[model samples]
Target: MKRNSLLLLWLFIFWSVLIWSAIDPKDYPTWFLEVFPALIGFVVLAATYRRFSLTPLVYLLILIHAIILMVGGHYTYAEVPLGEWMKEWFGLARNDYDKIGHFAQGFVPFMIAREIVIRNKVFKSRGWMHFFLLCFVMALSAFYELIEWWVALLSKEAAAAFLGTQGYVWDTQSDMFFALIGGLCAWVLLTKLHDRQLREL
Candidate 1:
């Protein structure tokens, strides 16, 4: 399909999901907290569309990530039906959809970071580029955790749902760990594909 058509489709899907998420969510505050990132992301992409168009792969990944956020927003991550089902099926202690979000947190940003590095010629060495990419993703994950902490401190009613920690003591650390792993996997799995797309662009 043409790029414009694809982008139109992406926007349609995003708005559709956003509207669905906004309708009688479990709680408005929790929904706002959860969906805020996706909204911010959409604004950023739209603002940068002319000057910093991303690869189709990156756009699709962003859409998937936004959908995850919206779904989590609508149901609250800890109580998402899919996560609950997975918890039962896997005999896990908590709904792990939040973990999936964390993983994507690293996964998607790594591509964005990698594209910037390559496009801007930020690093001379591939090794250094990869190292810097990992560092950037780790820092982003930590910052998001801090945002969650601040949100929790400010709003008791929305804290549990927003945090989605699900009583795990190592939630913060594990979230960053999963993000790191996700970044590593993205590097290994998507680098060549991303490189091809970058070349095309």
Candidate 2:
């Protein structure tokens, strides 16, 4: 596809999901909380389209992440049908859809960070760049936990749905761990593919 045609298709899908998610979501506030990052991503992508277009792989990954956010927004992570199915199928204690979100939190953002750092020559040493990206993703995950904390403090009713902790005491720690795992996965798995895409860019 031509670049413009591809961009149009991406925009179409994004808006379609955004609109669907907004129509009678599980809860307006929770939906906003979940989808706000996707909104920001859209804006950032638009702003950088001309001056700093991303690799197609990165764009596709961002779209996937946005879809995850939109779906979670529509149903709330704890009640997503897919997660419910997984819980039943695996005999798990609770819905684990939120874990997927947390994993993507690191997975997609790590690659985005990697692209920016490498393209901009932010760090000379590969080891240092990798270390920084790890810390960056971990910090991002930790900060997200703090946001959940603050939100729960403000609204007790929405806490369970937003955090989707499902009575697990170690939820916060585990969420960060999953994000760390995600970051490592992105670093190990996508680095070569990302490098090739970046070269094409």
Candidate 3:
């Protein structure tokens, strides 16, 4: 299929799934908010598609990240169905779905950046690229923490759901730490695989 047609088809599927999820009786108000970012990302990706095609692994990573966000939105992270069940099964203190979402926010984006840098040959130093990628993900994770703080300051109720910390005092630190791990893992796992895919492209 042509790139434009494929892009349109993906967009159609994305919006269709989002709409269906939104109208579902069990859906949370935050679900709509999650879709907003995915829509924005989709527009950006579509605009750049002609200039750059993502590897299949990168594409799958993006989809996984989107699903994580959507699922967190559906149940407000702290109360996500899967996490709740896992909590029960494992006898945990609280649901940790938000952790999964934040981790992917770092992990998937790391690969996205990796693909961009490697494909475009953005920097001469591969080591520098890897260092910068890790730092970038950490910075993003920290910025998101600040956003959560700001949201908490603005509205107590909304912030409760938004933070999804579930009374964990060290949640912000832990979130960033997980992001760091994710960034490292992404570099370790996808670098060579991505390079192979780039060859095919």
Which runs of model 1 end up more than 4 angstroms from their true locations? none
Ranking by lDDT: 1, 2, 3
**For candidate 3, lDDT tens digit of each residue in 97-200?**
87788789789989998888887899899999999999999998999898778878876767777788788999999999989989998988778888898898
Off by over 4 Å in 3: 1-13, 25-29
Q: In TM-score terms, which candidate is top?
A: 1
lDDT of each: 0.94, 0.93, 0.79
* Root mean square deviation (Cα) for candidate 3: 2.4
Q: Order the candidates by TM-score, highest first — what do you get?
A: 1, 2, 3
Measured against the true structure, the TM-scores of the candidates, in listed sequence, are: 0.98, 0.96, 0.88
Backbone clashes, each candidate: 0, 0, 0
Candidate 3 global lDDT:
0.79
TM-score of 1: 0.98
